[model samples]
Target: MATLTPCFLRIFAVLQLAACSFPEEPGPLISAPAEVVRRYPVFVGRAHRSYTRQEPLYIQTVLKVNRTLYIGARDDLYRVELDHVSGDEMFYSKKRTWESNKNDIRICRMKGKHEECRNYIKVLLSHDGGLFVCGTNAFNPLCANYTRDTLELVGEPISGMARCPYDPKHANVALFAEGSLFTGTVTDFLAIDAVIYRSLGESPALRTIKHDSKWFREPYFVSAVEWGPHIYFFFREMAMEFNYLEKVMVSRVARVCKGDLGGSQRVLERQWTSFLKARLNCSIPGDSHFYFNLLQSTSPIIRMQGRDVILGVFSTPSNSIPGSAVCAFDMQQLARVFEGRFKEQKSPESIWTPVPDEQVPKPRPGGCAVQGSRFSSSNSLPDEVLNFIKTHPLMDEAVPLLGHRPWIVKTMVRYQLNTMVVDTEAGPHRNRTVVFLGSTRGTVLKFLITPSPENPYSNTNTFLEELEGYNPERCGDDSVQARQPLSLTLDKPSHTLLLAFHSCVVRVPVARCQLHSRCMKNCIASRDPYCGWTKGSTCSLLRPGTRLPFVQDVEYGNTSHLGDCDGEFVNLFGM
Candidate 1:
């Protein structure tokens, strides 16, 4: 399980004790709100009249639940509720906070030629106790299920073509699993085929192969997570194994096998017998690396250091200065590069090899078989393993990056980091790690990791603050929600941080240290692992396993704990 040649020299090189390194140009020490003194107060997700009446509500999907908040917007659908915890906004609380009366049977937009009907609610899943919603209804993609405390509509209306994405600004990913829903989007209306599908399953509907440009070359999906019997997803295509006259793109991470059931109506019929796809290396390491290659946003499969990790949000379009990065990947290095080797590419004029472990084929083509197990599913494999997975679905190593670089890395800072979340509070000793990026001009940084004192298995970022979330001169003329981008939502049971902006959704504070540090050296220079400094009581929030006398260095801020605040908390700092 641990052998890939020093994990590829622990993934590329540049040692001080190598295994990962990068910071050739890192910036952001602290920013805005007068150097992060943070008073903490934002909370706006509903002014309703659709973002304060008469057109301007662009929030395309949010889903908090528990102090509720559903919100999906464009042709509307909402349900906000937050009756307490100071960050108020209980617009009709006991009345259940509703707005979704949607029954939507538009049946693919009933023959309208003036095609601009506008629905765009774009998939917002919740699972189990109901609330699955999906929409682009004007372009005719349906899907329903609501009522998490009366948002209504609970049965009938399902056929959201490749599971939503008829172009409400295409970017998809759905997920439900075992109760089947799994999507990756783009089934057509001239959106150009691209799919990963799987639709309402338990047996019939599997996708990915129709119009296959060698398995999706125009992708853009970004974000999907299930891990285990596999689900993965995360995208940014167009590098069918590189051919460049300038096209390249590549930032993938595919997988599929929530018990795949395809092949056997002539090799991959309803397709995707365990999809495949690799390449997500995110460069910056070494004798010329640099890469970043466009993967805009991913993070939901967290739990670092103890493993699992996800965190992406790369960028690379440089025509003269444009770059971004945050990288993290490592689900056992993507299951050891999807269990190693399988890239072939034989005829578009030969040359991208790797298929020979004596012509490799057995119980592996992205496995997940355990029903009676004996090659238990892709409809009973072995036609030479479905013809070696229809000419190999690409994968010959290239998953790298656990610490080959990128915890954060901008470049001349021209904005465009669209969305990421990763949180784990309560630590002066254990659970602490945080990172919340999101920028496309409205800003909201907040890093604070620490482990690499030169590879303690790598990691070391600390930007700490740049929180000016969504401004454009304070929405004058509603500034079209500032070109609609910036979508984070980590409501970890109310440690709060909703932040949307395309129709507005703001609730901050995943730590301004109990709403503005009352001292202990400004709560240890705001290294904020959710704040500390307690010994005589002041800068708060240290909860999990607190034996009292707090102080916090969280991973390595170590300001010598300010020599224990020298005497009666030096007046415990003030008011």
Candidate 2:
């Protein structure tokens, strides 16, 4: 046993932070497109509420189910059909969903003082042939079910204490998995106590330790998704490991097994037994690593290269670094980090250290119980193991990014990249991952990530032209999208990019391949997964539709690497 001095500890942390993930020389920064494309027009659609109100419209959540967009606003829920837009599909102030949209279902109708009781709809999850809706009912949270067919409230309203946030503005996550509802949100009225709670399930209800800063310290949950047997939650919280002058926010990925029954009623009564979290690293590896520590949003787990991948959108939400990044992670990588050693701090004054492997008990502490074992379930596990897990849930090593560097990094930009969505399409060689980033300025940026030509293990990212101030066909220049927080979800079934703003939900095509058809280099440089340069002299999807062959150079902007695009592109450039 050795005790580390304060000076030595500081040096250890500094070196560990720098030499953490990169075991060898890191790859070069990914290259941008040779020519920058700007302001690709987007087909924007604004949902029209049935009627106008006095207060400013504060749109909260836009969930797409089947072909309907279930939009949750401050006081109403408007259901807009995607393919059946009748009236003007523009962002007009007067044309509400009454004439253009399909259904205008009001989910929030609260009666209270406008303090914290304003019925701001927050959580909207489809469950059990209906909609499990919850709202911030003037500080008291309530949840109810609406019939899926008619979209009418059917069930009685019940308490949503741990299922939804008390403040409508707080960042929260609601996930419905295995016929259960799970949430990461604050429970109290003042919005101080944050929790990861599971309710309305066949299994016993479980939650994080209450008032325990070790579990959640001022956490702002980004999103949650079910991967394999575990529910992964991405969030940014105050780091409990470091005690600096100013509190440092660290990105985290927390995991909880879906089948976890609460621990023994004696030691850990209704608390989760399979709960663990690890720091997520989205940094540029070099002499000095620059970190995007605030995780804003995460894309759904999409399969790529025979592995499940999650693309996270991280930014300096604290406004310290005016930059943002998009990082991809393999789900298996995070599973390994959780299975690694556990970290613990002896006291407030002691340094956070990893517990020796020999000290860990049998069957593992934070793992789902086996069907046949000495301790069949967490409730039957030994008190010693439960106590050990109760204190130490954080992993020692941070989860490294998929590659050593971020796929896309934008520093000193005017707008923070708050949200992103990922679309994977078949490329000439393999599957190409396209990334779409939404900014605070109500714009969407597109890019693609492909394997590097020099090193297959490495990756190269290409940025498409920004979707600058171009108006949609129907919408005028004076649209209603304000400079508010944005959220992005890619509807793969419909091939639509669903961008949610404060005022409306805008739907646009995933890729504008035709915009780059004029120039062969530009089409290849676009790097959009849904697009390709065809031999018939046009840009289109990679298919045999009267086109001889498709020319794609997603790897690098150069057509030579594609092996067959040598002379075909020369004629396009008048060479």
Candidate 3:
């Protein structure tokens, strides 16, 4: 690598300073004129909560089981019935389940003083006909189980180090699979040790190497899920494969086997045998590599063909560029990279190189013992495989995005996209994928994913709706209330979306786009698939009683049927 000159270094520093200048617009800059654009009003329903002097009102997590919607706040849990609300209902009510005890409020000081020692429920997973709950108990986390019917605590507190975050704002993930809990988080109170641990119901826990350089490096955990026989953890961290002088961040997927157990010897005593990470590339197709380095959020969607694809929301860091992008990674594409060569750095100043197959340890490091072996337990496996996994966990090649391009790209903006949820609905001709993207401005935007007419391999997304999760006027003096989206979950049974903000949770009905449009021209111009012009001179959902004459996809902004439109639309122009 070449050394940077003083002149070039000065210019680079100036460019970094300009990246912090925030834009005035809260979201992607829309070029549509205000006159022709129709802003639809969102119908929002609130969940009730009993506020106390010490308890915070903000909702941290949202989960739906059966027909009841379960919401977790800092100190209380509530369940709201979905059947009471009619099919076309817009609002509903709530009922409380349980509140936190004084012991849950116990606190311990770590980085800052006056950090409130309160139980903020961060992890909520469903298991065995009940809910598994965890909270940040003032840096000392705790976990418990509750019955789904009564919504009451059923057992004593359990360890929650990897299940919950010490701070409410820290990134963490928890998943349940095969009657076990898998989590990735910082275990220590000072937030130092970032570990991936698997806890069986009554068996000893299995974790990654503690504070190991090759394992993790201050990772910001995004999402975790269970594939065929492997559990994958997605996160972003400083690139350890690069030279020290080049400080770049990369998104990665680390995989561990469901049957993995700790090694027997001193090399990796309670550590993972099937642990490896590879880069996730989300970039444009060009010579000048423009990378979206931040993996802010992710969602796993199972397509109609029974194939799974992970949708990730990525953005350039504040020091690089001001932009956000969405990319989808197919499981078939990711599986090939994991089977490729491994990335290794010989020296501190040297670049990463792929290790030859001959140099790789026998039993093919990171492979499960069941593969070409008879051992089912970690104690029975050979030590050579465990030793290789301790150091060579990073892969040589990077996993490319699904279509060689992002599905949605927004640049020169301010709002950072936080979370995403996807659902499939029946279109006029075929099934269409609808995406719900949450932002930091307490706004949830919806779009319909379709194929481009010009390029079959490429895809297009049509903006459908915009919803504000909270009331900006309620903030009064505090501006934080107007922003901050905590979580977003789609309820298919109720045909509603549950959005969690810093202060509360709101339910917004989907597929109501036609009811908000006043004119046929404006409805079609909005490019929303849910909104269509009907023969009754009004915008509405398609039904058996409706007669259709002018119906187009309207996704490509095609107005060729404008000449066929009759009614007040033609008379207003004096045609």
Candidate 4:
């Protein structure tokens, strides 16, 4: 490990670097064909209350346990269960008070902020066969526990001021693992003290990183996940290494070793001994230098094989650009970048450069040392390594996106992709992977991902269906009403998608490809594992114990393996 000192020199060097500017040449907008856009049925669940004025409700988070979907909303918590075909609310708990203090509201207004200050249940985590919920209790935060069986609050409330944010729209990340809570949010009223803290049992809370521009500048956190003994946080932050006078946002993946118990008090104590961040590259290959700079959401999909892949939705840096894209990164790729040479600025003004391979610190200060029996805690690590990690938290090299290009890209559209989820299932011919994307304009999209025959390791996707997320009546006769989606969640057991909007939650069954495919060519073209073409010249959805002699291999698009389906019959539509 290399001890990083002379911080003043680095800061001075940063001030000297000249800004680089490039002319903006956005890509041309493209639209999908009409035939490929198929609509699915949706079930809208709205509040049943009757009031003089309909209050707005945002379903910010959702969780599923067996047959029920637990929805966390502004000032309320609702349990929705499958009522045979549609979702039915089992009960609604008024978990939070919607009223905000007049002083708080006035203060926020005086600061030129328009958002209301109220207690919204922002955190609804499933822990130990129960629920651990946190809410913005009228600027003051509170945490409580509830029983899933009885739907009753079981424990007394605890202070959640630092654990959750008061503003509903503010970006925060939280993940619960091994009976511990890991959270990243603002810990103050002014939204200045942004911190990441780990709370384990009754032990003293451990916090790392602060509001300092040297650490992070205007970070918008997207996702957090735990793999092995480390928890990773993903976000877009103002590029500290960039010499741009204007803000240049870069995607970042930061990791923290879970076993780290902070540094020694005087020297470098109570801070993460292993906190490292690296840039995430999701750019197109070739001379065009096309790149997806803004990261919106991330879905970590575990593969049937040993490795896992992260699927992320990104948009162009400029909000005016009408485009969005999806990219995937293998876990191995991320690990390699973290293990690579560190990036350093020789002088504060010098361009950030990667350290030579041979010059990198031995034993890699960012590497996890607590994984083995030799060192179970940070105390066992050499003092040199601990000191090196304290200052050198940012890695030089960036983690490149898998395939060197986005798997899916859409352009010429007013709406941007907001959230996504990936599900892998058994297909008629082979294993099939599907992605559900939620758009900002209240649309849910389904796409089937198949392994490219030309490149077996890579994947190609086909658009399957598009579903309307908002109800017609509630949307009114505006003729152009589109509610932005707040969250997207999957109900694995029920084979359904729970789409959360500001006004309502819509539960839509995963496209019923099995029941709807009618013709041989239709089933194959649909590229849905749920539906397959059989020998009788008819398309059939797959069912348990169902057997077929001929089923289309949608991935390779090869029919040679399967016999013909009757005679050549093309059913014409219209005219």
- Top candidate (TM-score): 3
Model 2 lDDT on a 0 to 1 scale: 0.72
Off by over 4 Å in 2: 1-55, 86-116, 317-319, 426-430, 469-481, 492-494, 514-575
Q: Could you give candidate 4's per-residue lDDT for residues 146-251 as a string of tens digits?
A: 8775567786778887688867767888878676898888787677887778884543577775655655677788889998778989888888888878878888
TM-score of every prediction relative to native:
0.35, 0.81, 0.84, 0.81
Which ranges in model 1 have alpha carbons more than 4 Å from their true place? 1-71, 77-120, 123-160, 163-206, 209-253, 256-266, 269-274, 277-328, 339-433, 436-448, 452-455, 458-504, 509-518, 529-575
- lDDT per residue for candidate 2 within 416-497, as digits (tens), equals 8888877675343335667778887767777767777776545776665466322333232334346444678776655667
Predicted model with the maximum lDDT: 2
Tens digits of per-residue lDDT, candidate 3, 515-551, equal 4345666556655554566655666654322345444
Considering lDDT, where higher is better, how would the candidates rank from best to worst?
Answer: 2, 1, 3, 4
Compute the lDDT for candidate 3. Answer: 0.70
Candidate 1 lDDT at 215 equals 79
For candidate 2, give the lDDT of residue 451.
75
- Residue 14 of model 1, lDDT score: 27
Give the Å shift of residue 538 in candidate 3.
Answer: 2.2
Give the root-mean-square deviation of each candidate in angstroms: 19.3, 7.6, 5.6, 8.8
Candidates 1 and 4 compared: the better one by TM-score is 4
Q: Any residue pairs clashing in model 4, and if so which?
A: 13-348, 13-349, 14-348, 263-269, 343-396, 514-541
